[model samples]
Structures are given as C-alpha cells and as structure tokens.
Target: MNEEIELKELLQKNKMYQQVLDDIEIGIHVVNAEGKTIFYNKKMMEIESMEMEDVLEKNLLDVFSFAQNGYSTLLEALHKGSSIKNAKQTYYNNKGKEITTINNTFPIIDKGIQIGAVEIARDVTKYERLLRENLFKKGNTKYTFESIIGSSDKIQEVIDTSKRATRTNSSILIIGETGTGKELFAQSIHNGSNRMSKPLVSQNCAALPDSLIEGILFGTRVGAFTGAVERPGLFEQADGGTLLLDEINSMNPTLQAKLLRVIQEKTFRRIGDTKDREVDVRIIATINEDPIDAISKGRLRKDLFYRLSVVSIFIPPLKERKQDIEDLVQFFIDKYNHLFAMNVKSVSSEVWSMLLEYEWPGNVRELEHIIEGSMNLLEHEEILTYSFLPIQFRNKPQFQSERNTKKDLDEMLIQKGRNIKPLEEYMEEAETYYLKKALKHHEFNVTKAAKALGMSRQNLQYRIKKWKISKE
Candidate 1:
C-alpha cells in the first residue's frame, strides 16, 4: 500500500514538472524505448494540428508513419542513442498539409539504461511562405522613389536623375560606395518605368562563381552539357521587365563579353543550343567602386563599362551629405518606433551632436542601424540621449582621425569641458554605449554578444533590461 502511494506521489510531481514544458511555444514530444509516446505537450498538438487523444500512448512511428522509413530525427535518435540538433525535416501530416520544422532530438537515458527520446521543434512555415510569395507570383516592388529618405541637393539630384531614367529603356549604371542605396535606386527606377507590371529580377554578380553565373543568367539547353536540362535563365524570366545586375564590376571578363553581346544584339544563345533566343530586358547595373578605377584594375571591361554607363547615376556617401543627417535620423526613429511599438518622441541634443560628428563608414545603412539599435534600447524614455548611443560613437579613438586637425580637436575638448557632467553619469553612458555596440555588432544575437562581452547570457540580459536596451 505504501509503495502504491509513493508511486502516485512521484507521478504527480512529474506532471507538475511537465506542465512548465507544456506552456512553452516550441513543440515537445517524448517516446519510450518501445516507441510509445510517454509525453506530449500542447504546443506539439498545435504544431502538428493533432489532438492529444490521437498522439498520447500511440507509437511514435505509427502516429507519424511518414517517419517509419528511418529518415526522421526522432527515429534517428531512437536508433543511434545520440542527439541530433537543428536537423531540418519536411513531411506531410495526416491531413496532407506540408509541415517543415527545425528539430532537436535526443535520447533520454536514466542511469545506464536508455529510457526514451525527446524532440523539440520550431515551426518555420510562415517564414517560408513569405520568401516564396516575395520571390514569385506577385512580381511587385516593395520600394518606390518615395522610399528614398533625403532632402539634400545631392540626394535629390540622384532621385531626379533616377526618375528621368524611368522613361527610357536604355541601360543605366549606378556608382556608389557600399550601403549608399544603389539597389534602392535600381528598384525605384524599375517600379516607375513602363515595365512596372512585369517582373523586376535582381542578381548580385559577386554572389556566384563564373561557371554557374552563365547558366543562371543565360540558362541551358537539353543535352547542352553532360546532364544539362532545358531551363529558363534570368533573362527569359525577366522578359519585358527589368534585370538589375548588382556589383557588375565583379562579373568575369568572359561573362562580360557575353553580356555585352546580349546588350547590343538584344539576343542570346543558350548553352548547348545554336539557335538565338531574343529577350527584351531593361538592364540596370550597379558598381560600388569608381568605374575608371574598376576598368584600370581589370575588374571591369572597358567596352562593357561603356555599354552600361550610357545613363549613369552616382549616390553620395552619408558624410558628404551632413545636412540630411537630422532628417534621416528622424525617419529611422519613426520607422523603428512603429516596428517596435514604442513611442520615442525626440532625440537629445547630446546624441544629435554626436551623430553629426561621427563619420558613418557604413553610410545610410549604418545610420539606420544606429537608430534601430537606440530605439530597441528605449524603454519608458521618450527622448534619445547620448547614453543610448553605441560604444563606437562614445569612444574618441574611433572618430579621432575624422576630427582632421588640431583646431577641431581643441574645439571638441572645449565643448567637452563646457559640458562636464558627473562621474556616475559618464560611467552609466559608457556602460550603455558598450552594451548597445556589442549587441549591434553581433546583430542582436544575445548568446554570441554575451560571449564576446565576457558575460553570462542571463547576466547580459539582466543588464539589457535594467539599461532599457532593445533586444530585437
């Protein structure tokens, strides 16, 4: 009788412990050595669209018969008595709905005896759906000329030139430093043109190797090469539309020659086929370096450069357009405020001064990131201050070279002396700066940032909370 009572108490304790796991968002499942389910959580039922009665006490492989072939992480873990982490699995459920999950499966061992296996799953169906929807079907553009956020003469000049280019079908070459919104101009020009209803396909020339880029851009024919199948390339896929070739200088000279022929003749021959396939695709190529420098260095062919530069546009860097910094900062703050569901109303004078002084090497993208990082850290505070800026901005060494002369340094020192604050205030600002910079540098990946900062993740999280830093 006493043993029976003890068994019931132990089961009650186990149920109490399992309740915590049941409330989590990730799906959890456990099956014994016999493959019969011992535990199933509410999230698992929701993820699989199944009821508890249908899964509990059922054989794991029998419940998910698709896994009976020993291809699933659960089955692999059961057979190997080892852990499998982040194994991506795709299968159809009983209702014929395709499900994809990133799963972590591991065997559960009690003492030296194998007891069961556990599996945790995270659903990524919505993410995949978004990717597919954006890649095809709609052929819609997300940004137009209005999305370009600057009122400076230089920026307005580029926007005006881009607008003019939209009326014609001539090839355009965009030259700008990294992060100067070259792609933004390309998309805006495409969306504003007569081919707005057609697809606007984009490919980075630097992203693929010479061997594959040809096939991807011009496609292949059946029996063209050893296993070649008939396939439509980007040119065909983008027929009657626009094709934006980003980082055009990175394309191989041989591929450049072929591209030049296509640009001039308005036709291309597929690999392994002698017949020519004509395509009407408006070309917009972007280069992150000076065209002359690229040609001189042999990274870009002279003839190809001339062919592409018929209509050229240059976007100035952020440092060159200091007049637009305030406007850009406000734009980003508003954007992130909407995204993060916060009410950040104003920027502190100290922060504004700091922003103006810093030379943004990453340009507009870097400014956007800085604003985003600051907005994430905002809590109840309505005003953004120097304390919210990243460490890269607070440190002198990072911006000392940009000060340029002794006069500038002296003026900066005078400004600092006039604005002398309390030691505790300075220390707090320093801490917040380092924390924000670390988080930003790691792309808001808390685990990696915590490791780099030489602190435990939990402790860093606590500090983030206390400092009102943004995690997302």
Candidate 2:
C-alpha cells in the first residue's frame, strides 16, 4: 500500500515539474529510489539522445551506457542520499554518441527515507573541442568607433570627446579600469583620425623589464647591448601614424621624461647610436587606473600626464553605466549565437535580475565572459534561465543590491527616527576621515600631505580647520 502511494506521488511530481523543467536552459533528469527513471525533461532527452519510452520507468544503468563501471552521478546520489554538485561527467548515449556534461546531482529524502535523486546537466562538448583546437590567440584587431557598445550619458560624453579628438593630432590619454576596453577607444580614435591609413603600433609598459622596455620603445643599434639588433622602435615604425603606450603609469619615470621630450621635439636617439631619428606619429596613452592616484604614487610623471591628457577620454565602468547592460547582453548573445551556430533567444526574468545585481568588478569584459559561458551550456531551450547560470551565481544570494549591503549606514543616518542627514553631511564626515589619515601618514606635516593629496597646502589647512581635523 505504501509503495502504491509513493508511486502515485512520483507520477504527480513528474507531471508538475516537467512543464517548468523543460522550459529551462539546462537538462533535468530524475530517478526513483530503486534507480528507475521517474521524470525526464525535453532538454535531458535531447542532451542524452534517448527516447521518452526508452528512459521512463527503466533502470538508469539499463538505459545509459558508461565506459566505467559504477560511474552514474544520479545512481550515486540515490544510493548515498547525498548531494553531488558541479561534477564533470562523460559517457556515451543510447545511440553511442559521445557526450560531455557538467552535472549537479542531489537526493530526495522523505523524513529519514531516501526516495530518489535528481540530476541537472549542462553540455560543454563543443566548448572543450574549441579549446583543443588552439584557435583563440589571434583575435580580430580592427575596431571602429561603431564597435563601442553603449548608449548611457556617461559613455556618450566620452564618445563625443573622442570624436572631436579625431580631428586633431594632439596626444590623447584614455583612462579606465582593467577590462573596461581602453584599447577599443584608443583603436577607434586611431581608425577615425587622418592617420587611419598609416600603421598603428602599440607596446605595453608593464610587460617587460625597465632595461628591455627602454630598448623596445627606442630602437637599439647593433652591439648596443648583448644580442642587440639594428631594430627600429615603436616610434619609428609608427611614423605618420598612431603609437599606443599601454599602461603608461607603469613606465619608468626616466623613460617618461624621454617620452615627454620626444612628444615635444618629435625626435629620439636609438640606444648606442649617435644619430637621432624623427617620427611624425600621433601619440596615444592609456592608464588602467585613476591618473590622479598614479600621480600621487609617482608612477606617472606630472609633466608627462599634463601632455598626454591634452585630449583626455574616460571610459566609465559597468557599474557607472547600468543602463547599458541590457544592450550589451543582447549584443553578446547575438555575437555568440553567430559564433557558436546556436539560436538562443534571451534570458528568463530571474536570470536577468542577477546580471543587474552583480557588481561587475571586471566590467563589460566580465559580462561578456559570463554570457559566452552561459550560451555554451544551452540545451534545446531558447531562453536562458536560472539553471544555466554558473555555480557561483547559482550558489550566491538572490542578487543583493549595493544599497542593500549598507543597511547599517542607512540606519545610522536615521538614528532615533530623526530625519536623515543631508548628502553633504555624510560627505563631510568621509572627508574628515580621509584628511586625518593623510595628516597622520605625513606625520602631521600639512605641506607634504597637501602635495600628496594634490591640493594646495592653504586649501587643505582651511578644510582641516573647517572639519576640526588634527593629529589627536
């Protein structure tokens, strides 16, 4: 009698869940405590390449073929009454087609009794095949101004400035966090400018040692140093074009002085060579962090910064341009759909919510990666759902907003149920803390602290008195 009731409950569960599970992006398979298939969604059927009649009520081992004995994650979960997550499983289907999947399996327990197990599977066969082919190193380099993807006001501001900059050959500085597409803006400015026909050469300041870097920027004459060749540096090679100095803050201060002179004079001497060569190259530089912080740390020379920033363009981070996420998401989905030859329509509302809630520390690049990865795991479903998200996103809370994380601060602002403090009051308190730290770091030397903080000593003194900030 108990077995009959359990079977009835299983049938009801299969009917109730099939509609929801079949609509999700990943595959779903469920089995009974006795290892008999209880539910198989459409996605699972396509993933395993098996018929409904062939799987339902049939033993898992009898329906599927595994090269290794006792290798079924579903069977393990059912027997052990345990949960297995994010395990990569490889096996052949009923038709002998090799399949690769990332599986998350869990047991269903009723009171103290183990009833069955459910397994979620994501196919990664094509993604792994692409990795083995070594086809990722050479990416398409041609990026036009249209290639930039954003419609936010902050982004449009930079775009407008960059477009105006293309009309002039003045040195330009592009600033943003890493993965924020600094190179894209630089290439766009170059491609749009009159120097479009000329060659564009770029060198990373942080990729080599100081000694080797100088030689790289300014060509070395034969016998200039050990194994030195008669090679022309980036400046000579990029003559009449654009030369990109990437992460300029990482360049040595001395090298920066030489660079400043070259920008001012349009000439540079090769190492161990008596003669100087002239290049009419348009200079473009990028800083992967705040230029003000770079100056404070003495990583970038003040004079060099002043020169390079003649036409400054700042690319806002993903957080600062939340309005663009939807556009970028659709853009990448369209992009990967073409590359992977799949027809994924869109993400479900639940999945969409998580994308916006994410802080996006890696900015647009990180979003692109997450989207590409999710696309790789799609089954027969057209829309991406919660099931298709990465394990990190799946395991985390249901997308906490930035404001939600600072509830304590909000409470302090409304203590005793008083009206909240004005924005400037909070700003003043923050300034007070910052000034005190700077003063203490400089051992109460107001002049030095003011210089390091990029403010006039008199101005800092006035604020220090205004906030009553002191060593004590």
Candidate 3:
C-alpha cells in the first residue's frame, strides 16, 4: 500500500517548489497539450545542453526532434491520457549532439481533461552485439548464508542484517578492510534474494585501467576506436541479476558519474554509441576504505556514495572480533583436513597463543591461508604444533588491539580494582547504551542524534554498524 504524503500547501509555494525541482539531479521537462514548454529545470538544461531562455515558453518540437520519424513519448502520453514508463527516446538537440534518454512520461489530467505532460530524463549511451545468456548461467554464485562461518555476536548480527537485506532490491555498499569477506557476504545476499535465479556477476574495478574499464562496463561500439568491435559489457550481461563491484573507490570519478546516471535512470550509454540501453541489474559495491574518507579525498563522489549506500553493511575486522578466532581456527582446520585427507586434531597451546595474539592484517583470508599452508606439511602429526607455523609466526605480537572509545583510559583505571579485562568490552556496553538512548530520543533520526552525540554522522554510523544497533 502506498502512503499519502501531505504536500498541498508545500507545493502551492511555487517559488520554493520550483527551486527544489531545479535542484534535482534528474532532468524534468513539462509541456502543455500544445507542446509548449511550461517548465524546464537546471538539470534538464544540463542534460539537453540548452539555455533557459531558449527552452522555456518555446514549443518542444521547435527545440528538439524525434529522429527517423520517431513519435514523442510525452506528446503521445498527453494525447492518449496515459503514461509511458521506462521508455527510451532518441533525439537531436540544437547543438547537433545526439541525445538518448530513458523517460518516464505522464500526462496531467485536470478534472478528467488532459492539460499537459511531464517527462523525466537521464542521458545514456550503449552498444551491444553479444549474447550472454550462457555466460550468465555458467557464472552463478556458489556461496549462500550457510557458507559464511562465524559465531560471534557481531558476526551473527551482520548475518541477520544481510539476510534482511535480501528481501529488497535496493543497492548495497559493503565497507570493510581488504580480505574481510565483503564479496562473500555479497554472494550470500544474491543467493538468498528473489533474483537468485539470475546470474550474480563480479568485477574488480581496479583490475583494468580506466580506459579499458569503461569499455568493460558499458561495452564498445564497432569503429569506436582502433581494434574496437561491437560487444556487450558487464551491465548487459548482469541484467536482471546482480553486479558486485569490488573496490568501487578504485573506479575513475568520471565513470562514477556515469554509474550514478544508471542508478537514477536504469539506463546507460555504451562506450562509443549514442543510443541508451536499459537494464535491471542490482548494484552491490564494496569499498576497502572509509567511504567518508574516500569522499574527502575525491576518490569517491558524494552523490554516488549516497545512492550506493542505500543499505550499508560494515563488516567488523578480525581484530575487532578476536573472540571468534578460536572458532574460526577450528573451522579452517576441519575444512583443510577433509580436503587433504589429514586427521589434524587441533593446534598446540603455543600455536593457539600466536594465532590469538598476532593481529590479522589480512583478516579471515590470511587465517585460512595459514591453516592451508600448515595442512600441507602435516603428514603423520595428529596435532598441529608451532613447528608447522609459517616463518612470520615465530614472533608473537606484543601489542593488543585498539579500544576505539572516549573512556578507554578511565575504564582501565576502574578495571584494576575489579578484574582484568580489555577496555573495549566495557566500552562497547556503555557506548551501545548511550548511542541507543540518543537515537531513541531523536526518534531514530541519525543526523540529529549524531549532532547531539558530538560526533559526525559517519562516526555515529560506524559506531552503530559496530554495535549492530537495530533502529527499525
């Protein structure tokens, strides 16, 4: 059921409403029944490369033309008193630049009489000549929710959140350090979602250079450049499924703008083609760096970040969830033992101390690699000992993990009188309680509560992600 939004009085404020419309990212064009342009926004001007003086109050047919006798979607909607949803329109602007857009045209009905039409547009170009149905089927994902192995409260909470995310088609941004299983969670989400029947394609944004990645994403047009041929891109192949963009911050900012258009309009332009191609793929981007930091450094566009983080999932690092190390070690041992026909029971006390003390710079992937490397050397030994460890494991870490809280020093002083404990465990409980109170007081508005908490919204968000605070 659709909920009604009260905007009668708000929309009646013409100047304010007009300013809001012009500030929108998507192009908005309004025309009367006679095809005279009544409203044209700033974004529309940018999209069509026309000035406000030339477009407003002018006839739409005079400024632009549908190529090859193509009918106008907006005019058609007005005459037929209907809507043309997700329709592609190709036309030539005054500058002679071929413009292709995905338009949602709707007619305005005043007391059952057709008054005018409005068309929202986004610029897109695409080229295609390849069939990818077979490739889509062959690259189906193997991981599901069950494939993820962890039992810590933080890991379980992240799992629950990911399971809930599978019910929606919204874009997701998974943020974590390298080797934190960001792609593993992405695969699990895809396999559990309604779109599971469709292929789940993966791409490493940094795998190719900028010039080549564009061609890889949107495909190339024949004669686009030397040695260029018509071919489909990942967007075409992943249509009706999911596209997992690993290390999305590594993508060029220029291409990031193009990706934003696709998210907004569900259409994209090919590398060298003028025609726009529509697709229905869900985007899931993973970033190894802090997104706020990425935006500050201009590696990521803020607008793109906003769109991509519709459902943000932050996976805690291995050091943050050290309690799970023992369980993870056992799981990996069982896995490698089965694969290598070894009967290794468990690690020795020395090996266990080394595993728990040393900081996992490579996270879970590093742990699995360590276990696999040890399994190869285990021939007759029933128990994995320190001798089977890697060369770097000879020296144990002397430092403990960080306590990211304001009260770590104060808590340490108090803990000496009671029992010895890491400062993080005590801070986690207090921090979680205070954050919940602040959020509840603000009716769960993160922006307002974050301000009240004397922290940036991103900082508050990180804390919430770490603590797994349920706002809904």
The digit string of per-residue lDDT tens for model 2 on 223-310 reads 9888989998888889999999999999999999999999999999999999988889999999988898999999999999999999
lDDT of each: 0.80, 0.80, 0.80
Lowest lDDT 10-residue stretch of candidate 1:
61-70
Give the higher-lDDT candidate: 2 or 3. 2
The residue-level lDDT of candidate 2 at 246 comes to 94
Off by over 4 Å in 1: 1-141, 396-472
Worst 10 residues of 2 by lDDT: 129-138
Error of 1 at 197 (Å): 1.0
Model 2: lDDT to the true structure:
0.80
| Model 1 residue 160 distance off true place after TM-score fit, in angstroms | 1.2
lDDT of 3 by residue, 1-472 (tens): 1222346554568878898999989999999987789999999888788999888898775577543324578777876888999987766576544467899999998998888999998766332001112222345538788767665668889999999999999999999999889999999999999999997989999899997998999899998999999999999999999999999999999999999999999998887799999999999999999999999999999999999999999999987766567657766776666568777767764475566656788999999899988888889787788778765655444422222232564564466568755667766776677679779989999976754443345456656876899976
Look at candidate 2 and give me any clashing residue pairs: none
